[model samples]
Target: MNSLIRYQVEDGLALITLARPPVNALGQTLRAAVLDACQRAASDASVRAIILHGDGKLFSAGADISEFGSAASFAAPSLPDLLSRLTQLDKPLIAALSGLALGGGLELALACGYRIGEPSLRLGLPEISLGLLPGAGGTQRLPRLIGVAPALDMMISGLPIDANRALELGLLDRLAASADTLVEAARAFALDLLGDLAPARPQTPFAEPAASVAEDFFQQYRQTHEPRWKNRLAPRLVLAAVEAACVLPLQAGLERELALFKQAEDSAQSAALRHLFFAEREAGRIPGIAEDIALRPVARVAVIGAGTMGGGIAMNFANAGIPVVVLEQKSEALERGLANVRRNYESSVSRGKLNAEQLEQRMQLLVGTLDYADIADADLVIEAVFEKLEIKQQVFRTLDEVCKPGAILASNTSSLDVDAIAAVTRRPQDVIGLHFFSPANVMRLLEVVRARETAPDVLATTLRLAKRIGKVAVVSGVCFGFIGNRMLEPYNREAHRLVLEGATPARVDGVLTDLGLNMGALTMTDLAGIDVNFLVRDSNRSAFADDASYYRVGDALYSLGRYGQKTGRGFYLYEGRQRRDDDEVVALAERLASELQVERRLIGDAEIHDRCLFMLINEGIQLLDEGIALRAGDIDLVWTNGYGFPAWVGGPLHYAEQLGLDKVLDGIHRYRDSLGTYGQRWFQPAPLLERLVAAGKTRIEKI
Candidate 1:
């Protein structure tokens, strides 16, 4: 027997265990071993039945993702071929599942005659997330087993269902009463099947389609999901593959699934999604931080300030079941902050996302106070106070004086220098930037800024804590605005400049929305508050080039007290959450153009898309060359998670690579030549981009 496979026979049952430690990822070598084991069990007269299980924890996570796009992935017996052979076995085959059975793992389970799982089982075909449908008979076999609608939901959403839900959906034959008894239960179940002389049951036979599934069911699913699925190829192809199962025979359906899988695999959208799948995992690994580094225990957390950002930051800890103390300067502010947290929880309860008991339990974990001494024992202190540098430094000094030894000191400054804040602390090694986005509790991204003197353990601990709080944390070197916001400066500059040169706010935003961003740049500014953004720009005024027309319209709006959604006016007028274009804003832009001697002309959607996105991409390359971002993918993660960059086009850097580095370079030169001084100053191509283009390299990570 192969070392990767543990084969044994007991009581006339051949037990085949996949012994790949960690996730039992199905690779070529493991696939070959599994095939040999199954063939051996089928031929042996003494083995009346066979049971397949993984060595530990999980049945399998899926195929070896690292082997994807490599020649090894297609080496026979491929997953589809091996599964096809499994269905032909004369003896009954049973899959005993535990933990996760995802993608190819669940597809393997579906090929078995019967599947019995532990109560901890989680099953799904999540290939759609990587921009590809399941290639190994999943699309065809699943719909036949579970019917069309449920199978479509499972494949398209790429979300896992628990053991109870799987059992209820008829995806599992039976679940073991407890996780510890899974193997024993499977053995007994196999014995019972052998005693009854049961024939091998395959999922090839299809019953009549579900009554709810109409002839136009797939079309309706597409129409309803098109907005979310726009620019995404895999989800639409998944729908096609599932529809094939309903009309075609088993063999024909499997062939159609394979064809669709190959098509999706070759698409740029899938390639981008696959790149991101690896990038998100790679973002966690720091060069100097070893995997075994001891992490600080964060039993209690403290937040300074009682404003919206502070309250939201506190809720994150409370929701994660950690005790949190929120400090405010006055009694009234502290009460209001605590009340806001309650309202947020109450809103969750209303949405059926949290129960009444959960709401009270989370709220109970939050304690509001007015004294810094009250948070002296906190393991982690995050100051979400005012954005001023002096204010943050003062808060850090107080935290350094009061907090216990080994406590982490974090600042929630979006664009300020983390090193400057750390310089005020006695324990600079403990100081780090935990820049959470607005509505901190709701945003998925967390930028972890590491100062020059930051210890490896401190960085590692913050990354671990970020995961615990359900945030996609990306480590960034210290710089003004860090990763996300620093790149945003150039992107926003072009949007503001485009409006001055002729584009309206609505048109500028519409072009971006059409390109698949969550919203347009102008709309995002309005949502973030024009006055707030103007203030941020003013604080960083030294960084901007000497241009008279730079964001002048925004400055004008701020002067007019047009503060956006909160005030119902800014770049556009707001009616509640809905917004409409304002002719006055356009008039203001034209007036600025005339006073600043800037020529306003017809701006097409193409220029609007290219100028904003390409500048963003250029700034990202500059960040990469400057070492503010460790890898190109880290920059991509920051944009996709934090700034609403579409995943289908990948992040800006990856999208640039897809569009060809040479073309991006050419676009920069073209803008520089046409826009004269303004373009020459801002559109200068980064050295890294120029070098990559000269070298004819398509991948940004080559450096």
Candidate 2:
């Protein structure tokens, strides 16, 4: 073995530690080193077994993300080859998994004959979320170890299961109760495996009936739960890979999985999702601000409203172990709000997600009262009341009156002026906008809107608070809808305009779905509830209809009282939440066109996608130009969080870059000249985009 592999004989067993630092990512260079180590152990006659482990807090964190999608490495036969070498080698290999065993890290363990883990260890295949799959035989090997159905759910969802779940699924051979015993237990398992004269685990050959059931179970599960996965390329491909394990030979299955991995990684979906994954890691940071921002601990949180958002926000805080107090207007309102909160908690309990004890514990922390006096000393107070100026003014006036002066006061205002929300209070410096998406506990994105008069500490506080409750907080300067909704204005406008021109609602949705959105543009409207969409439309109409044209589709639905899910009707009918295109809506489009004296012009899918998506991109550029968003990437983060902006699409601006800067500019101009001003705000390109276009730059990832 080369110098990278230390061939020390520990009682006739080989002890090979992966010396690469920082989670021992198995990039190309490290693969050669690992392969050499495995080969030397296999070749040595005295060595009966090998213990493979890492030096740091993790076994391995998969392939270095930096080398993810590239075609060729300077050295190494790819991640799959390295894993195959480990599995096929004569020496029985044991992996000591600690800290994080994810992606390629877990793949390595699967290749080994035996695996051991500590209680603190986390093992998962998170590639599906990044629009890639486990290329190193994770798909085939995992189901062979665990049952096919459980593996399908795990890999397809891309959510990490802890050590306990990993053990339940048979992913690990043995799990140590404590971290200290993990290595010893792993070594013992290795000895036991080496003692066996049976050959290494080859292709999985489960019984015939079980294999057939596995296929049926997986197919049914995908059809039932992820039928809408029509948009994402990875999920279906991952399902195919998992299915391959039951049929194909081990080596052929590995090859099939690798081909899918390479295909997904290079697909526009994977590139966009990977770009977003990196973008999110850097989203919270500001350039000039010190990396070590002293985050004040928000141990306890208080919400001024007990409405849906307020209750949801409280749940998020409580779920994170932070005590929450919900204050409402009157005794009746407080009681009703508290009831809603309890119902939410009980629902979780009924779902088996939480027990009665946990439900009670969380409910106990959520104290409800009519007075703001209870939360006067709270660390953070978020008001999630109605967006009405008067109602918000009253809440802030009361919050300022009773709450301790230093407590960060936040408003969950979607589009109201944060400056105005701040103006109602004496401590304007402490007031900020924590624009949590609806049902805050479920969403991952939080827009920390900074009012002009807000203090730097307050800005820092909301940013910190966002991360505390498990959200990607993007610092946004105050604007109508801040960043997410601001950009969405143009997107919906162009979608409506496309319908006006020649396409149907289904066609518009089709284009967006092909672009990788989870739902089509019209489908999203239906999902959000037509009434909810109408309310936003009316609000935007009152706010900017005079300056920019309002598409007539939304209000027309509102007039018919077809307000989406609640009414069981919308642009598309929702029959028990199964979305189907509405013929009535198509007729409405025709009627509206006739009323406006506009001829229906047939539009292509590309034009429909560009007009809708490019308008949003243009608006994002404007936000960047006006300094509403700190950087171009922040805008993308907001969209990924709040909107179903496909993480793979990398946000509107990133999509713009992918389409080519010149193309985006040309599309904007063409739409502007053809569609009028509401459509043309997009035609007026931002200086940064123009600069990039002039310089022939096509990617925002570099920035």
Candidate 3:
């Protein structure tokens, strides 16, 4: 096989270019080739210096994360081994970075004698996100070059810093004017280094922070970030590695980092997080869509509401530099929506996330009007209206009449059947569902609900547009609530049942929090408003006709006008955002249990956690078997991104696969036998689940 690294000689300099396609990931093959190239350069009599860069768009997007946990990761000329050799090279080595120098890529740059990068280059060590530390020399070398604080901040957060910030922090030696000039600049830098003829610094004994100060920062970081890092091992492990760098010698610190990296790589958390990372990427791929399918143009966008969801949706387009026309029936509503959008932009400006000029440019892209004609020229029209079926149909009818031919019409409905809405349009293929989560601009998840009649090009175009607007779009077949909310229904149902069966809302929430969820079920319910769920249940009465007790606690709370935090009471009492257990809600549950002659019993934490999680998992299986979800991982992406399902758990279906399908089936059987009718009604094993268990498959992929 040809080498992934290209070696050439020019002007007494060995030029090594990483020639891997796409993002130039540092896999075993690339590493070996790089090492061989370096060896060739070192042995060449004519070569005075070496200049390293990458072909195509990026220097590197970091290590080939797909190789994690595989034997190839530890193959000869491993990243650490190559970096060490580069550091010890007798000839000066210069790195020319253009696009991204992340994780192992940044470590490779740091190992060289001199580093020059394009001004727009993105650099960081983001292994913390995959539940691992930088296994090479990142943990040891970065602090030595840029000081302890900045290095710690970058590693702990896993966020990339721009080249300018990198230069300011001393991470980069110099910045070229543009990517086109990076190589020549690096060549000049290497020649300048040869003229100076200074001996290369030995890579060891990295700089350390004051012992007392380092201790304080780690402690403070753990305390402040503990909630976000709940049930996660990598952040703490990363901190430990960084601390070792502060206290130990370079080799010792690297050894400590390697040990921690191995531990994290083997961890369940790392496996789950890595699964989610791949799942998110897999969500965009449509199995049947042709690779060469032409995508519809979506230059002008229009939104058919000015409420919270509408305003947020409009902001996404405006942020992407696409002009948006927001239409409402009343001018007052339109004005309120425009004001909300302005306030959101101003808040971003206040946080230094955006400047006044950026805010103005974004706001300028938003056009609010009361006339439908204003939006006729829009290529995409999304209706973020109320969740009622009639309202959605009426909006679609109007959109069909007013929207120009080929205009993509979408609904941000959470529960209503998307096909029914599409049925009202003259061009059903143009109708799709772009279900953005609440605070659409901030949240990354967007469920692209593909209707039965939705054209391949429409699906392809919407998925592409979602990326342009900074959204993680997952394709979902037409179904009630699509993927996220459909699975969420069962989870919410079981949460209410658990409370009614004598578990406190706080206890249930606490268990879920411990299990790695950002918030507990009841806590999320309260935040979302109890009446919202009650309204959904009311609208879908036929689906729950067999079980009157379904979501009963929520309905009762809503009946009493205890809407949620906005009303100061629902599942729990809230006093100025502080939630406290309330006697009245508990009494209401007790009364309902007595009326139905349903004996209430104390529920353990494990039971509450399992019942809620398993039911959600069961629903996801049903979605998979019924073809509502394209793949198990896509369902995982929906939950992890849209529903706050812990990424560390790898979403519901993956979690079930990890738990063993046989074990999951056994639990469902046990629940069916114990709960009698209720269990039989809800715990029916999916055909796919039963078949997979029988086949002894441990992963959804095998199924």
How many residue pairs clash in each candidate at the backbone level? Answer: 0, 4, 0
548-586 per-residue lDDT for model 3 (tens digits): 775778888988999889999988888989989998988
The clash number for model 3 is: 0
TM-score: which is higher, 1 or 2?
Answer: 1
Task: Write the residue-wise lDDT of candidate 2 on 72-158 in tens digits.
Answer: 521476878888878777766778888888888889888887778999999889998889888888888887777677777789878
Residue 506 lDDT in candidate 1: 94
Clash total of candidate 2:
4
What CA root-mean-square deviation does each model show from the true structure?
1.8, 3.6, 1.7
- lDDT of each prediction vs. the true structure? 0.90, 0.79, 0.87
Q: Rank the candidates by lDDT, best first.
A: 1, 3, 2
Check candidate 2 and list the clashing pairs: 273-648, 530-563, 530-564, 531-563
Which scores higher on lDDT, 1 or 2?
1
| Model 3, CA-based lDDT | 0.87
TM-score of every prediction relative to native: 0.97, 0.88, 0.97
